[model samples]
Target: MVAPARLDLDQRGDTWSSLPDHDVDVLVVGGGVTGAGVALDAVTRGLSVLLVEQRDYASGTSSRSSKLFHGGLRYLEQLNFSLVREALRERELMLTRICPHLVRPVSFLYPLKHRFWERPYVTAGLTLYDSMGGARSVPRHKQLSRTKALRMVPGLRKDALAGALLYYDAKSDDARHTMTVARTAASYGARLLTSAKVERLLREGERVVGAEVTDVESGETATVRCRVVINCTGVWTDDVQELAGGRGQFHVRASKGVHIVVPRDRINSETGLILRTEKSVLFVIPWGMHWIVGTTDTDWDLDKAHPAASRADIDYILEHVNTVLAHPLTHDDIEGVYAGLRPLLKGESESTSQLSREHAVARPQPGLISIAGGKYTTYRVMAADAVDAARPDLASNVPESVTEHIPLVGAEGYHALSNQVETIALRQDLPAWRVEHLLGRYGSLVEELFAMWAEDPSLKDPVPGAEEYLRVELLYAATHEGALHLDDLLARRTRISIETKDRGVTCARPVAELVADALQWDSGRVDDEVKAWEARVAAERESQTEAADQEANAERLAAPDFRNRSVGRALA
Candidate 1:
């Protein structure tokens, strides 16, 4: 028995063509981790759920994050004990039970500047961090002398540190993890659609009964009735609140963080590095073949979709990270650059980094609920809290959240399959590395995708110009992940655009063709998709080179808006 490939924008016309003319129990707007989590939680509790997004899943801030399921060591320093404990617990769940295949433990080295005073001060903190709930997942922190630390990382400058402390945190592929969770929601009978925009809230006597949705691809509109509407639009939460008629109980602020990626060989080290910046923390993390360094937090008043990285932002990270490096990296060394906005809870402080990371839920109206402002690590908790709050308006005695014990679709039986990758690769006539990649991303679901390749052996070859990716992955994205445009496959489904040095320039056309078939596009439509994707990349590159954050942000907003301009254009 096989489940039908997941529904997406390419199939929106056919899928929604026969959608019931009546309302659903809940309509969730946004497809990030939080939104997907909400859909999954709501469905398990017996609520009829429908989740829609303006673009592909995880295409916004979700995919652009630092890629760590962290407990936020900085939060511990701020005396935020509750946040750390809760986040640590979540981190353990992701690594040990929830999605072990996607989340894994990563070690980070923090070098001490002042000799005697700093080591003990930092050692005590690291000890407490290592002793947190389910801390057995990774090794405890270790203190090393200056010489030993230098020996461990020969790339470090001689005068950079007096000593070092090593500790652990968990990392994940944010985009893939999000897509899998959404698929899990679908398996549980929730209706999930991407590239479907919510044009307006359908209100009946001051209470929202449902939402009017527009299919961005075919230009068709449908009214999806629901007993309640959950606004999980992250940075756009306040804008969604206003759509419900300026009646929200709370507000949210946007803070932009920019990061740069370089090849791993440029910074030779055995472990990842964490450094203290004047304003915030800087992480030199290990991606598959690259090192991710960054994160400058500043108040953003520009575009939320494309938060630009100004020249100052780049220099701030470079300057701080360079202080400890034997060799400094220039613009030429950067392979890719990206910026994302954090939906932080608003505060009196001007510094974005100083703003609260805590989340809040409010039922500003009789049938509308809005959730905003929390770090990615706490997504599940935030989703549970949201459904609990919206339950009252659901007008039913809903059961307790069941998602905690639910393993996402690909999570169950993952550990044993990982051990069988080499054998599977041999039988499939593929490289072990490729098999590992598939298992890491899809877990036991790889068998389903591999069957497609077995039917047509040509699909076994790597994607043109994107050799690390197989054609089957692109096919899987459209068939199962709900990708619509070339951007959806390259930018979110596979991350080839950001992972490649040419930024997926050569691979765009082939991916566009694949999507064209799935969406039933003509020559003109295909050409428009290619043009739009190029323009999107051009705008992002231009924004990164700007001298100031606001200028860069404004320039980044020049591309086409994802929201339907005919009705809900200004996303605020």
Candidate 2:
């Protein structure tokens, strides 16, 4: 097997210089999971592919998700059996064959309030859920009495439940998983570009042929010729469609989802919890040393780029989850907070919560195709469908997508390395727990980090303020992963931004200085990056205090984007 491609500064320069020289069979316009999956599918099917993202890969809604790979249990209530079945199939594939290193099974306790009717009703639904996707990697749903449930969860209030149902689902680091998908696509010979925006579509008398691309950092422009352009821009779908000189077939509405992170000990549950709300469902997921509880689904019309979580949003989540908790949580308990937007296909329903999660692909013109509106679990299917839509436009006979059998970059030898964690720890002179942490994040790719550690011992030191991550991880983010800015490294690459109380502010300078050499950032550049990140954190903090969405959004937009700086010197 070929080694995964390095998306370092050198590769970025080369790819940029060669952009206008050749025309690819497919030009995927987005860096989120759907776009990344499309790139992987297209390249593996014997097509020349190039994927470009306006910002960093998974920098938008892709990174900030509920981080689950389950068939939507709530969708079962909506009677969307087909969607649930499809998602469950993908969930099984992710756990066993695809990216097992990143995705894992997580059990959730569904507390039953009504004694008689609720148990039987929920039982029937869960039974159908278990049977939908065959041959599951996780155990089936199990019924638990109130006593047993309280024994398992001790944090729940005594009167909160008469009984409970424990069901299994899969969870993952969404940002990391999305980035891995892009890297896997790169490994398959797809040219991936980030911080590159598509200004407009290049057309030949109504038949769209290519796009006018701009390097967001340097302000340089290039025309990328392609056989077909697949639009996977998510919430920015309409903007891309407008660039194509048409409204396209549909519209995409943005829905805001807010989540708060707190220390794991604050929620004394052995497993995660799922609660039903009036609008939708709430998930209190286990995220390493933290518990991620959230998600208030409300219509967001303000800013698509940086969706801010209002004070009201946080209160709503706390209000709902507090109903069942033995000790109610307050604002002081929250360590980190983040908000993400969902790109829903605009339907007749005014409520974003009621909108469809099912995706749609449209070929508005001869050479252009747009795909929108699916959940993260079905991204592979969405990508395959998008590629299938582009087949008619391709001059040559296109092969069918084979991404189903393909394992992501780090999945190849993950289980074997997992078994050798203690041996690896002894060999590297590190603690067993540290080795386990590294293995969980990088899987078989932990060897790459070990190789770096062998060269520079200091790289193995834990990052200050966010000791969970090592300095080597930040270095790797710059050298191997395509991290162009400080936000890219902290927010998406390592998730230190949302895992720590200070929101990565304390470790900002250290991380920037560590990656300086790899990114060719001088002292001035480093200072600028740190200041920008600090301002962003401050802005987000201020925004979270506001009661209304507009007020919060205005505050979040106060920070300056550091990546908007001109590229005066070429990266080494």
Candidate 3:
């Protein structure tokens, strides 16, 4: 097994310095899941690779997703059987072999409104769903009477359903999973850089060669020469294709998806809920101590960096989910709200929900490949397809992708370690639940956290407002997990922003102070970081009250991004 790569400021400097020295076989543009998957696939296939992201890893659509790894059950209703099968296969791989520590089974109850036809109609679809992916990692679907269903989910209104169907899917912390994939690729000799933007593509007589990248923090530029460039930027696909000096084969449309997080006690359900709406389906997903209920689909053309959820978007979710709940939720019950954009391949359908979820791979020109329009569940398949499309430009002996057989860093001995949780907690002088939490997030990588705790026992103490996460986890984020700013730690690494009612403002300064030494931040810099986060939270709160997208977007953009060099304050 390859030794894990430490992704910190020191390694980032080393990678940036070595950029002008050598040419790589493939240069990937984007740092989301697909880009990370492409890097892992390309490097493991014996190609020298470099992956660059304009912001932090999974800071975009990847981090702000439904956080489920399931076959789109609704796709089966659309008769898109092939896409469902492929996603289901990948879901099984993630559950058993690839990242067992990160992905786990989650059950959702599908309520039946009609008394007769709905039961068999849904039963056939679920049976097909259970059989399509070959070997299953989770149990099959089970039918429940209305009384039994109400007992299972006591919060459901008695009149909302005549019966229900319970089926299994999987969920994960998407940001952490994507970062781990990037780290796993780095462990296999791939170079990775965050806060680096690709200014332009290097061209030699219309044949693409490399890219000119700029450091977002230092304002320094470097020319990186490579054989081929894979454009995996999600919503910004068109923008990057313009850098290549041509229009892509297909256009990408950005669809806005918004979610609201509320405390778990507000919802009385052991299993998650799935509801059908006029345009699309809604998921009431169970997120640790909070319930993530949302996703309103609408066209968004305003700000791409931070999509804002307006009053209407939140009301739409509440109206739909409240139809089945015994107690309705209000704005005051919501702890947090977030918005993300989906990169859908533009089609004849006017509705964004009607757009295709299947991905496409196109060689728009020689030495360049553009991949767009896929669901999160099928990222590995999309990466494999994108790399396969580059084979003609690559060497003759370039091997096929071997990522299917390779386990991610934390998956090596995760199951064995999980069995010893009680013993580990006893030996470490910690509670059993804390050990379980660490094991679920880090898997066998918990050993690394143990080493830190051994050095400083105080690191085991919990954060001030976000007690669910230990101080050691925040230190690990700065020292090893490549967190450049306080937002990166509170927002993505630990999920303090959405999990807390104050949106991480109460703990922002304390967290900044805790990670100051590892990130080399001075006292003034610490104050600046905390202020930036507070401003962001304030903007989001103001934006959610607006009625229109234009108003909401302007409100959200009032906060200057600390990572943007134009803001004149570099958090990096």
> Model 1: how large is the Cα RMSD against the reference?
3.0
Better of 1 and 3 by lDDT: 3
Model 3 TM-score is 0.99
lDDT of 1 by residue, 125-220 (tens): 888787775567888889888898888888899899988998899898898888888888888888888878888887888898888888786578
User: Which portions of model 1 miss their true places by more than 4 Å?
Assistant: 1-5, 8-11, 18-20, 561-572
TM-score, predicted candidate 2 vs. hidden true structure: 0.98
**Local distance difference test, candidate 1:** 0.83
Worst 10 residues of 2 by lDDT: 563-572
Give stretches of model 2 more than 4 Å off: 566-572
**123-176, model 3: which lDDT tens digit per residue?**
999999998876389899999999999999999999999999999999999999
TM-score of each: 0.95, 0.98, 0.99
lDDT of candidate 1 at residue 472, scale 0 to 100: 85
Q: What lDDT is reached at residue 423 by model 2? A: 90
- Per candidate, the number of residue pairs that clash is 2, 0, 0
RMSD of 3: 1.3
